[model samples]
Target chain A: MNTKIENKLTPVRIIAFIFVALWLVIAMFPFIWTLWGSFKVQADFFSKADWSNAIFGFHTEKQTGGFFTMDGYYGSWIEEEFWRAVINTSIVVFFTVLISLTFGTLGGYALARSTYRYAFWILMAGLIFRAMPHMTLISGYLQPFFAWNVWGILPTTIIVLVAINQPFTLWMLHSFFLNIPKDLDESAMCDGCNRFQAFRYVIIPIMWPGVITTGLFSFLLAYNDFTVTSMLLSDENETMIPAIASFLGTVQEEGKVMYAVAAVVSATAPLFFFVLFFQRQIVSGLTAGAVKG
Target chain B: MKHSTFLLFSLPSLSVMFLFIAIPIVSVFIQSLHIEHKQVIIVTENCDPFGCETTTAVDTEASAKLKEKAPLGKFNGFKTYSNRMHFAFDEVGEAWKSSDSFTVFTKKLYNYPLYRALSFTLTYTFVVTPFVLFLGFLVAVGVNNLPKMFKGPTIFASLLPMIVTPLVGSLILFWMVDGDGVIGATLQKIFNDNSLSLKASPVLTWIMLMVYGIWHLMPFSFIVFYAGLQTVPQETIEAATIDGASKFQRIRHVVIPHLMPLAIFITLILLMDNFRVFEPIIGFRAEAHATSISWLIWNHLRESAYPLYNAAGATSMVTIFGVAILLLPVLIRTWRDFKEKNKG
Candidate 1:
């Protein structure tokens, strides 16, 4: 490119350039702070932990420690409980996402294809369920777990998560099926293809975006979920957030507080990567429209 | 033929959904009602009979019973309703009523703090939704119309805040806004007196919360609206310009309407998610005057010294109904007014 031509960018372009650049820094500031703070030693944290004093004035004293060390990471490593939380969160996220997606896809396809009366009502039921506050289910439904034995306890937590997530995944994919005009199916039938074949070949390919987006969202729905897990799950298996939370108890148990951040960081690792890897689609895909259900 | 095909397409999905979600919900409802004698609600023993051996084996069969029941009532319709009828926690009457110094509103109000909670969420939803939408739109439109090279980076740049977890987001806000702290001290440079805590004043707390919410949420909205803008038909905008439509008018009439469906989607998500909030309250409640239905439940559960479990359930049931009412307007619009909008 010629130098003069490159320099001849429009005023609008120049203006947007600055705005978005400034925005990216402001946007990344939190994550950057989290990353940096995760590395800092305890005395440094005591200084930075202060909201009023330390932020702009954040500094390291030379005598005490290395500027960039793994005190937080190593400190958190000592807690056996923190590792168990890792297991707990993974269990919930794995089962919750897998189950909801399986049933939700089926449910979405059914609601989309139903020509009968009350089909909309069925879909509406899902929407109302989706709109319900998580606390409602957690509060009313948690009692039943006490009714059962040991096996019922784990499966019960998974059920709460699946119930909470089903409506979201179903409604999301249902819209995708709807936006696909009905003519494709009609034409496929005229071509002598059966209902299953049309959906398998023609409809499914085009709706892949919706499926992927919905699947990713469902994965996120389960992975990012904390409140339901917090309420539903009992001890020893408290999902990641609560595990980290147990560390922050009024007592400075858990050997050190930094591991709480480490545990939080590890728990969110899959979620954070999912967001970053799927950045374009996630950002573009999650609309106010997502609240439709 | 079409019907059969549709049935084939639909049945499998419907069955799984029915099996998992629908059945569980119905089961919960049934469990909530306590008329059935078979439905055992084991009230834990005050004194372990295992420890207090030979303690009052009153009846002949009482030893075989599961820890001895207390006339555990027989199941009947509306039994759950009747059991909790006096515990509705509402003040419904023709006149305002007083319970000691606190004046409970009569004429059927939802739980008092719940009203405050709902209102608090509503105020957040209303302010944050539009503010984020408009800010996102401005950035998106401005960035999209950028030199082709800058658009991609700009879009990626704005998405960082939306991707971080709520815990981290709160921590950042915590670091910046503490009293006589970093952010406060920074403000003190301009406003004087670093001793002022953001938590000290309701106004400051609200302002900071608004800032935190918008900062975190704007990126998500910007990403979606930007895509919606791209799909916006260019010729219509060009024609509007040719007809001498000013920039403001063009956006108000042309761009905004194109983005309405997306806006509604964002609104619905915000309406649902913000109302059911969890993190912000847990983080800010120490100093801030903020508390929602979510945080209230957490506080109760956290202080589980009393195991306020039943009360939490009752509170949750009421909160769900409150949310349903809040969402009812959209429900009415989607069901009844949707076709009207299409025709118009």
Candidate 2:
């Protein structure tokens, strides 16, 4: 594993390396471009007369003489109350990851330990449920929630998101839990620990990697969701993505596209940081299912 | 674990699954059968005072009473499902009956909501899935061949699009494709056309959306395939090379075979995910040019006044049906695998 393959350079290798380098630039350049544009004024960023204005910010007139301006950020965060959306998003992500992980850990442990027909059937049902678009379930939620007068609140939305996230959480954690030696649980039980205690002590310590991975995914699901939140949450409870979307309609109509651009940048910033820190978990979480399947 | 312990462990998730996922499916089916209450209008004519006038007013009291009596309105069975938005049975029949030419008939197909969405959804699913897989494989092989120093950064850069929120990702692309943005402006200058814009035409918009689709999904496939490539037995490659097989021959015969299961797994996931496409259309503001089944459902739910609950339900059911159809092949494959494992 330590020895590097010292193959002679061929034209094919050069071409491949060139393609990889080009793709790397293509993949990473847009975010940098947009993030830069978000710091400039509207006219300069989306200048019709000169494309260089986007980069140079020549049209932006602000006290900061440099090519960047904070006007778009100010307009979005201060005037548009994007902070409220940020708070809402944090609440949703916090609770969604917490609750889904709690429930998923228990269910996935049980499924992983069991050698029964029920576990198989349940996993199968989960596969089917995973395939159902979230919108289909929203109509069902609407009738009962509206009838009960609990439609648009944060708790209702959280509960629904938790429910929606459960199947994947369960599937992921189930496979992860399966990877641990069954003897670990068996010996813990044989030592006078009950099943719950065994899981609490013996399994919990070993399962953190899988749990954290699943939790990260749950957080991303809650954070990046536009469909369920946009549908279920009222105006006051809108998350960042949906709020940014709402801005696209009205703000863009008002010729304030920069507000939406700034908000988009703000919304994506956390994810960029999240990836920088937890890229390992994200990659593992993604490949886990495919490899298992 | 004992039965009681097992029940205690599984109860929370199972209940949530049943309450949210299972029951909602049945409710969606039932809801699609009944129509929402439409306003009863009353018109009257007065021939006195200033002049003869006609007025149209909503019979709110009667409508309210009707709503109270049957909150879900009348049970219309499958009527809503057959309407222009869901199955478009009537429109398809009429379009066939009325069109004098193939072009006219195909143009009329766009007028039917379900077919319009189905056409785009199918095209996007089929086109984007294969391209992503192929491009992902290419990138995976290329990156795998590179020095270890370059791999991490390349992988990191690639994952940004896949990780970003779909709506935000699409909007970033939308901004770039706008008339004034870098890509659009560069494209116009290259073509020497003053009137070129990505948002201006349907075909171009579709291509842009598909391109976004590939971009957004490419990293997932690339990562998965890259991981798969690492597990390819080096001995096989060595053997193929010893036989004087070219690099292409080695990959084609050995590496690809090893990666088949993973590729199929990615394909199944990509199909299911792509079939429910909704966010990009909204983000790109491409609804005027392209619609998906999910968008059709959301459109009904967000409609002014009555909100078309029944129609939305029907559309959701239709979408669910489409997803299930897409999933059938994958399900069969999984079932066969399970059966083979049990036999072994």
Candidate 3:
């Protein structure tokens, strides 16, 4: 690794470049595949498609340009339920992040500044809670929700997402709180500001990146999840991932896989939106929480 | 006064944790001891003998059904375990069905289809998680010293995958991977017919999964790692340089300790997530072959035809046990640090 950099123009340097270049090529395959698969019609897709079914049978019966047609592929996201999933994910992401930021700030400050006896247990518990699979809550636990009511939507999904995201929120925020130099807290105290005032005015601004990244994670987790949502949400109207799979599953066996493939491609938009927006802050925030105090 | 206020701040989070996180864990243990709403171990003391003699016919029928299959009555501790073991051992030659679609063990959990679903799922997660982390870390380290003008956007691009909601991301990958999808048609136009079937290939499906997984998770590790990199004091690096420390030396001596906590955090996060991971597996199910342990468990809950719902429950607990052991150290360390930090 170091051989390439030592001379700057050595064979090793060229090899290193080639290796990285190759890595990029390998990494680009799936995205390329998704794009390629979007154009092929159903029959061509079914006959020739092997494993990566995203493009194989992507054609339709209409002979607009022979084997090509976007309608056969990209038409599903226009469906009402797809939009409902968007709204459903948005609702959970917005509120769950909101809850994490609000509570995480307070809890983090408390952990950083206060003498609490059970703080260790709380932290450990939070770690375990975060570590535990969200699916367990839906499948193994929460019998009442499955058995008793079997109806309704908002509170159930919202509450569960909120709980699932809390552990990561608490763990990450606590680190952010620890990073603030104690002198800052002392200086605020000396300036006649109480702890809350110090936290609200002095600390919160500095910790904005932490709050943002944690909130981003919470939002992403809620939006991307499938297992708990599959069990907790029986309603097709509220389904988030019911449509994204392509070229495989029993759906493939039933001949709908091609259509499903088209539908799933549209799901990539929101995540792109997040990456496009939070690029810098996410990096700074996560590295800060991970690498530093 | 200062410490107490902090406690006040922590209260809502703590309470919420107890209510949602803590309580659910307790319920898992409770459910494990005795199956819910059945007669695995009939609680005669609760109602029948106590004089609150109200019982429904449906409840009676259910209890009767439970009792008939339960060769191990209330006095029989874990008799079902032996029975299952016996069944598995006896059927070694013919473990699966006549159609040979799936095994008795696999079918017992959710129907054969769920495990069928899981085969693809496990295939994807096993392939996706490690490679994403490995490649992500390399990218983070490589771009660590670049100028912000180049570095910021470079790292930002990696974040592209993580930022997208999984639902949306999977859809995009789904379209992008198939040969007839947008990119494939263009490739075919440029290179002709030989290039189009990439999405149909199972190997290509995993490649797509790895790409999507990397795209989604790279941002997370990059951000986390970049943050950690920022904290590595210039003084330490300067000191290493003055002593003629090689880049490897700096990375090994100065950089690694500097990044240990972050690395551990991300790795642990991945481990916990890997076990319970069901989304990408389920999401990519159509084309990309995959399923995780959690998905199989879920299949049992959602799919009624699953032969052994109880066995799936038991199998899922196997995954939980793995998580509990792997994360015990992190949980312990966090507890100690949290206590120290909370001391006013």
Q: Evaluated with lDDT, which candidate comes out highest?
A: 2
**Model 3 chain A weakest 10-residue run by lDDT:** A50-59
Summarize candidate 2's per-residue lDDT along B146-207 as a digit string, tens digits: 87878889888998999999999999988887888888888888898989988889999999
Which portions of model 2 miss their true places by more than 4 Å? A1-8, A61-64, A253-255, B40-56
TM-score of each: 0.78, 0.96, 0.72
Error of 1 at A49 (Å): 11
- Rank by lDDT, descending? 2, 1, 3
lDDT by residue for model 3 (B199-250), tens: 5666666566666666666557656766667778999899999999987788
Using DockQ as the measure, which candidate wins?
Answer: 2
Q: In model 3 chain B, which range of ten residues has the least summed lDDT?
A: B71-80
Q: Is the docking of candidate 1 incorrect, acceptable, medium or high quality?
A: acceptable
Error of 2 at B276 (Å): 0.9
Cα lDDT tens digits, model 3, A95-180, are: 77788678877887777665455665677677778777776655444465655575346567767777777777887888777777
DockQ of 2: 0.74
Whole-model lDDT per candidate: 0.62, 0.89, 0.60
RMSD of each: 6.2, 2.1, 8.7
Instruction: Give the clash count for each candidate.
Output: 16, 0, 74
Q: Put the candidates in TM-score order, highest first.
A: 2, 1, 3
lDDT of 1 at A196: 72
